[model samples]
Target: MATVRVQQADFDIGAEVAAVTAGRTDIGGTGCFIGTVRETADGRPITAMTLEHYPGMTERAMAAIAEQAEARWSLLGCTLIHRVGRLTPGANIVLVLAAAPHRQAALEATAFLIDWLKTRAPFWKKEHFADGAEAWVAARVEDDAAAARWGGGTAGRDRRTMAPGGSG
Candidate 1:
């Protein structure tokens, strides 16, 4: 099973990783990704960012994403934590961890999870600039392209199943 959480509080990466790997001797590799608030967006200086999402809906969407990752890869465990509400520059925004029997599955699953989250998750973000202006962040074409690379699209589309070895 996968653990998913959407909270306002920041998460400890080390603790989360340990929680996923604990009592798991079969996991030979673990892939992790941590997203943080940057000091700048585009060329503008960003002071802070506020993230918002529909509570129940957001959790359900994230859980589905995790499930998809586990189905597509040989994953033993997964954890996804996304922080909501206002966040300052350098603050942690999201964390994703994928554990599998081999490095390829672990790494690819992690990438797929994050990419899907960026494009499919229902989180909304508003950026506060240094000039005392605020604007809602728009969807990026790059994120959609990243997700598409993993054969991501409409529901019910068949995705290639990957195992420990090179064969899929």
Candidate 2:
């Protein structure tokens, strides 16, 4: 079983990793990734970014991502915590930790979880510039490509996936 959390409160990286690996004697390796608000992008400083998410769908989507990771790898344990609402620069935004007997599975599972979350989760981001301007973050084609890797191309496409010419 895996744990998934979507909330306004931020998560503690050490605590989450501890909880994920607790009582797991079989786990020989753990891979952890924490995504935080960055001060700059490319090279320019980012003033702020507001993150929004659908209530029910956000949790469900994250759970499904975790489930897929477990199914695709020999995972002993995993934890995903995502923060919502207003957040400041340098704050923790999300955490993903995967525990397994080997490093490969742990690493791959972590990537799969974040990639799927970025593409499929209902979260939206709005970047606010230093001059007091805001814009809704658009879903990048690169993110979709990342998710497709774990999705195994068209064979594993879901309802969220609609062909370019198909009505969405």
Candidate 3:
């Protein structure tokens, strides 16, 4: 099973990793990725970003992502946590962990989870600039390409076209 959380609170990565691997001797490796709010986007200085999502829908989409990774790899455990509401520069926004008996599976599963989450998850973001202006974040073509490389069936679709809880 995997731990999935969508919240407005910050997470402690060390505590999360310890919790997942606690008493698990069979787990040989754990791959982790932490995404943070950056100070700039496309050269514009960002003061903050607000992440919003449909409550029930967001968790369902994330659960499907974890399930897919589990099906594709021999995972011992997995954890995904995404923060919503306003975030400042250097604040952690998301955390992903993939545990397996080998490094390869753990690493690949971590990539797959983040890729799919970026493109498929039901979340919207709006960035606030230092100039007192705000704009909704646009989907990058490169993100879609990264997710498509796995061939999980979400290839070539515009980010806005995704339906709630729908894969790919």
Candidate 4:
């Protein structure tokens, strides 16, 4: 089963990796992706970022994405952790781990998870700029393109058009 968590607390990468690999000799490779709050976005200096999501809906979407990755690849295990609330630059925002019997499967699954999460998950972000201005983050075309590469039309949909309770 895949472990999916949506929390306000930070996650320990080492512990997460260990938990996925513990007593699992069949796992050969584990692809990991840790996303951190960057100091800048599109050349604008950022002080902090706040992420918000609907509790039940967000977890369900993440779990579904994880399941999709597992079904598409030969994954032995997977872990996805996304942080909410306020976050400063350099703070961890999300983590993804996909373990498989082969490196290719693990790597591809990791990529797919992150890409889909960026578009599919119903997470709203607000950026605090260095000048004390705050603005809601907009969805990027690049993210949609990345997710579309996985061959799903739903992945390319604009998140802004999604209904309040719908997953993009």
| TM-score of each prediction | 0.91, 0.87, 0.92, 0.92
Ranking according to lDDT, highest score first? 4, 3, 1, 2
Residue range with the least summed lDDT across 10 consecutive positions in model 3: 153-162
Clashes of each: 0, 0, 0, 0
The order of the candidates by TM-score, greatest first, is 4, 3, 1, 2
Candidate 2 per-residue C-alpha lDDT over 1-168 given as tens digits, one digit per residue, 9 for 90 to 100: 888998888787878888988776899888888989887654556688788888998888788778888888978898988888877789889999889999999999989888887877788887776667667776777877887777565433343536777643
Q: List candidate 3 segments past 4 Å from native.
A: 155-168
Give lDDT tens digits, candidate 4, residues 18-129: 9999998999999999999999988999999999998898898999899999999969999999999999999999999999999999999999999999988889999999
> Evaluated with lDDT, which candidate comes out highest?
4
* Alpha carbon deviation, residue 111, candidate 4 (Å): 0.3
lDDT of each: 0.90, 0.80, 0.91, 0.92
Candidate 3 local lDDT, 98-147, one digit each (tens)? 99999999999999999999987888999999999999998787988899
**Candidates 3 and 4 compared by lDDT, better number:** 4
Clashes by residue pair, model 4? none
Q: Give the range of the ten consecutive residues with the poorest summed lDDT in model 4.
A: 154-163
Model 1 stretches astray by more than 4 angstroms:
156-168
Selected candidate, larger TM-score, 1 vs 2: 1
